[model samples]
Target: MSDLIHKDPTCFPVLEAAGLPSAFLDAIMDGVLCSAEAIMCIPQCLDALCLNNNGLQAVRDRNALRCFVKILTSRTYLRALTGETPGSLSTGLDELMRHASSLRGPGVDMVIEILNAILKIGSGVDASFSSSEPASCSTPLWKLMLTGAIR
Candidate 1:
């Protein structure tokens, strides 16, 4: 069965299609990593989207985020994070953070990393509003970290 699955390369065309744009993929991956439910669907959706040539922009649509947030905010995602399943939102965030560290060139990865970090910290306070709050207020912290504003 394993060999049969491996022999038919089309069995996973999404991974191949995901080769589109690295920047877009990075953004979509970052969003999925931000939520637990979305993380569980990552492999399947990634495969399907890849087969259809759907790029990162397709995943960036407002409706997509709405749907992702709905699932993310649901009890299912929270339960999964609590150990009801193998995929946890924290794991996805960790993977994204690691990717952010290895990224080169422009500051997209840095911005995303900082944003995710702030969001994670805020999540502990209010999981609901954490997603809705403006990120601008968080900029000062980044400035402090980068410029040593406090020390």
Candidate 2:
């Protein structure tokens, strides 16, 4: 059906299990990317990314981290911050550091939590632990691990 083929799916936090329709996907993707700057706030957009198991899955499943990487590594932002394309990680960090002067308060707290999660994952903590139906706890451990990377 045309409607199904061109479904205007909402972006993250309202994900579709069905993969995107190839025919019109690029337009939708471009639209989402165009609006990404508005959602760069740590407490708002990134907060939603680190919310829970569903959120973690969304990041892993939806390739949200890659999207962030692209946004952060874009040439414009990189030039604004670093003046040259140093390398991969450096490119992203350059953009991340662009806002370094303004990062504070809750943003700082959020970054700390993210760093902790990244450290745990770096130190052999399983990144996908919670998605496997592990325990009876209200929260899943895997999500906690992903908080750093996705957010």
Candidate 3:
């Protein structure tokens, strides 16, 4: 039984089709694997999109910022940040910060633009706000700061 399973190449199971070339079958399997990999890479792909100029523009846009603020205001935002949310959409934001240091050429420029956008967002807070208002220390921007993302 061990020989049949391990040493006997003739006994090994293989995908078979009537007229398909072996290479074609291999290509099909590769495509399936690659698709699965791409699905698993949603966070990285989203970060890539968000790091580009269009994404940066979207981030800097006032309307987009307003939408972002609304989402962050939710109680689940913290859980999402901590990667505690159930599902396939947990945070991979730390990857963006990690990439910030290793980027070059246009990548560096894009990162700078993103950081500038974030700084503008941070600076938008009024210095004269009432003390009765809740602190923003736990917000996503604050978490970015706490993580030394600026450095």
Residue-by-residue lDDT tens digits, candidate 1, 1-74: 11222355454344434443343345554454434444554433433332332322354332232333433433
- The TM-score between candidate 3 and the true structure equals 0.26
Which residue ranges in model 1 land beyond 4 Å of their true spot?
Answer: 1-39, 55-57, 60-76, 84-151
Each candidate's clash count: 1, 1, 0
TM-score of 1: 0.29
lDDT for model 1 comes to 0.38
Against the hidden reference, what TM-scores do the models get? 0.29, 0.27, 0.26
Give one digit per residue, the lDDT tens place, for model 2 in 1-151. Answer: 1223124313432343443322123332353333323323311332333333454344334433333333332322322222232243344434443433233333344446556645554454735322444333333233334443323
Writing each residue's lDDT as its tens digit, candidate 3 over 1-151 gives 2223224333323311222223322332233232323223433433443443443333233122122232233232343443332133223434544643332244445445546644554564422211233435544445454334443
Best by lDDT: 1
Candidate 3, clashing residue pairs?
none
